[model samples]
Target: MKKVSISLIVISQMLLGLTVSTTVSAAAKPITGVNCNGGFFVRTPDKHIHWIDEETEEHVQVYDKSDDIYAMAQCGTGVVTVFEKQIDGEQQYNAIYSPNCMNIGSEKGLSSHIYQGKEKINKIDAKDGKLEIRFVNNTYLRGETCASVSAGK
Candidate 1:
């Protein structure tokens, strides 16, 4: 009787563990893209403009006017920004940037170049009061007319 009781308890514990693990995994879905109804602009640290459509997922980069790109990531609404940084004399860092927070990870394989393809932008609606900007492959900034501010008028 003791052996049978121990076995049943162990089995129950195993099943509970499996259920908890499955629930946690299912709760956290990987972010792969964004959807926006208005354009969001990204101005790199070196002053370059990247515009993305509201309803489409697009790649963004941190670059300078001299055409040197430091990092790249895909951005859109409802998606966290995954940034890959490869700057000289600095350790490479890759992570996800949320609207008001950043979660850094050491995952490898981050691209630093814009995908070679035709870029598209559709003015579905006039720019709303909010402007979304992803910077340095590390930060996501949102504000009204923030893109123009970063544009260095």
Candidate 2:
């Protein structure tokens, strides 16, 4: 069986300037080339959607930001495009758009870098636009594409 799972450690201190870094996964960032809903969490260079393929040094997912709003759900629950990574890898959580409340911040960009300041977890398939994710908590987050969502597949 594929030994995979999601884990996060978020620590906080009430003291001012004592910001404790939370152990979050990199799955919590806006889609690189395509804009989600209508927010530039990460600005796109020019009108084209660029993707840095580490393997072939290729470019472009060939996406048009004009077709934004991939997926939408009512609270901190819904499907998201998870660029999964193997265990002992960089990140593991995939962030998506949800009503960001003061208490519940499920919206993307809540953490600047998704996997920044995070250690690897138990999983496999290090890549973007691929892999599966299982949230430890009851929170809803999944790996899926916009096309499948629209088609109701």
Off by over 4 Å in 1: 29-117, 120-153
Compared with the true structure, model 1 gives a TM-score of 0.26
Which one is best on TM-score?
1
TM-score, every prediction:
0.26, 0.21
lDDT of each: 0.35, 0.29
Worst window of 10 by summed lDDT in candidate 2: 97-106
Clashes by residue pair, model 2? 25-114, 26-114, 26-115, 27-93, 27-94, 27-95, 28-95, 37-69, 86-124, 87-123
lDDT of 2 by residue, 63-153 (tens): 3333233222222222233233334754443323222211112223331112211232232221243333323443322335211221111
Among all candidates shown, the one with the greatest lDDT: 1
